[model samples]
Target: MRQPTLYLPHGAGPCFFMDWEPPDTWARHRAFLENLPATLPERPRALLVISAHWEAPQFTVQKHPAPPLVFDYSGFPPHTYQLTWPAPGAPLLAEQVAGLLQAAGLACGFDERRGFDHGVFVPLKLAFPEADIPCVQLSLRADLDPAAHLAAGKALMPLRDEGVLILGSGNSYHNMQVMLRAWQSGALTTHGLDFDAWLTETVTQADAVERERCLIAWSSAPGAREAAPREEHLIPLLVVAGAGGNAPGAKIFEDRVLGAVQSAFRFG
Candidate 1:
């Protein structure tokens, strides 16, 4: 059976590992991630995550057999930096991913030293806490072009048939400055809500062709640029959307976080 492609929100740095004043603020998001494995049709042979935390000049694959934990976030509790998800690396899948990207005419590179960054480890830890699955990390392109990432994903679509879960790890609404302001004010921001609504409509309602077109030109969506001053977080959705092919996307998770609406999607 073909595995599902996911676009998940790896929430604010170390949110799951630590407690906040409002201890239950992240309860819904945490529950969604913790229950992710049960929602999958089956255990994937291996997992491939496109991490917003990593951006290279070209598409890069992590090929280390025993990848280290990358504590990419800062100013977290002392224990957070010491956190680890000891999942084994998927070198074979990494090479296959490289070949797929090359076949797509996208430049590909390999990094033997790179490890699982926050974007990959955080959500994976929540979903598969046992750390039994082999995982690989793919870096986002430094240019952050939606079409390029989408093409890359289209090339990797074959992996789904091979039981590899391809996931795009990013947040839906990722403007820290704006999100923080809304959090402090205890109110949701209109721009963030508008952008989130537009995104939901584009993926769940639009046909494949229109979805691709809107995503390629995503910056024009209401509150898009405001929601993501930098496109790294939003660009991952384009990749997953492309891999979706004719399969419909369902909004699997949606909630208000720090006064911004965040969502996740699954494509099969």
Candidate 2:
């Protein structure tokens, strides 16, 4: 009954809920996200989402039974702020997650006050609009170290066999500066494509040891900094990679958005 894990790109700030001027700007992403539930090997019992939008001094798990929406983004339509995806939180899974991390010597805590940020809610809204699944949120470490996050993912690996879905929600290429230019020109930059190609090759390596090595040293990849700039969005992939154990990953979706190559992966 082992469940597959996912690394997804939750598109920029409320894009799914709004209309872009080009009309087709978000079409590909929207279709890909909406198809997520069907793409799964099986329906998951609970989802443990690692969000890029949330960062804490240490790892934190959401414990609230009814998690609220955080609306972490701004400058979208007024209705966008009012959006809600009222998925109940999984407190039991939170305990399990904490135990796993603590057992691995990773300092972790629980939070009753946290809510689902865009990273969790946006994709969930499209993927599972019913909001019937019990979901929990895990915060990224504020320090944003690749190895630490990868280690954290390794710690949580047991949850997959326990029927908990591990989903790392972040963008593949998250450079805002280049995104704007691509949005205007309707063309992806070479830096973004180069980095994305490197990521694809790295993650899809048949050898798990080599895949892990490449991810741990991800910064050295061509155009890595130009594509990510800040590592927040990219770090989620490391978490997913570690949780994968010996499982290999494949690019489930790949497309151009705001002139950047966006991709998603599934591990088993």
Candidate 3:
């Protein structure tokens, strides 16, 4: 079987599913998630998630057999905090990821105490609530550099061959504070959409070398800097691309934000 890896934009907050009105773009993603399981070519033995929510000075792997909750977000409905995503943790797979990092000339360790951050739980609850398949999560390195995250993903590439579904979860258009500000200032530009469009084209058309080059110099892309201010959300997609290495990306979902923000795409 061919190995498949994905870089998916996982938005913030669980309230995404509850919003029903226009200007609320997450509805598309929610519907997309509902269709996620049946769309898979095969059921994976395990899932390895690289969530933007989990960050560390060095890479950290979640290793508990029964990982706990990480209520990483704040200031929402009280029930949102109590939302349970009780998925079994994959300590063995987490070790393999750590070992891969070390073999690739990187420092790494385990975090048996770590819990499931919102990025993992939100997507998992929608995609695989059965909690039967083994799951593990890796943290983003401190630098948040594109090349570094891509390289880190390449290190974990072997997992795909071992029946592990590697997923790099983050958003494509992630300047939350900026976009919110642009809306408040009533001075929004086409820069973010322009950047998102350029990104989709590069991802769908470019070769591995060209794609890597674009990612490394991402700040120069049409709306690169504007799309991702901190780049934490954007970098995970690079890792997914690095892991897949020129494989065709089939966008299983696409949605425009309030007729403005270009927020969508999925790969396998």
TM-scores, all models, native as reference:
0.97, 0.97, 0.90
User: Which scores greater on lDDT, model 2 or model 3?
Assistant: 2
Score each candidate by Cα lDDT. 0.89, 0.90, 0.75
Report the C-alpha lDDT of model 2 over 1-268, residue by residue, as the tens digit. Answer: 7887899999999998888878987898899989888877788899999999989999999999999999888788999999989999999999999999999999999999999999999998999999999999999999998889999999999988888889999998899988887677766454388888999999989999899899989889999999888899989998989998886899999978677788999888
Which whole-number lDDT from 0 to 100 does residue 120 have in model 2? 95
What does candidate 3 score on TM?
Answer: 0.90
Query: Which rank order by TM-score, best down to worst?
Result: 1, 2, 3
Cα lDDT tens digits for candidate 1, 127-217 = 9999999999999999999899989989989999999999999998898997777778877444478888888888885478888888899
Enumerate residue pairs that collide in model 1.
none
Most accurate candidate by lDDT: 2
> Candidate 1 vs candidate 3: which has greater TM-score?
1
Q: Rank the candidates by lDDT, best first.
A: 2, 1, 3
Stretches of candidate 2 off by over 4 Å are 185-191
Model 2, position 266, has a per-residue lDDT of 86
Q: What is the overall TM-score of model 2 with all chains considered together?
A: 0.97
In terms of lDDT, model 3 sits at: 0.75
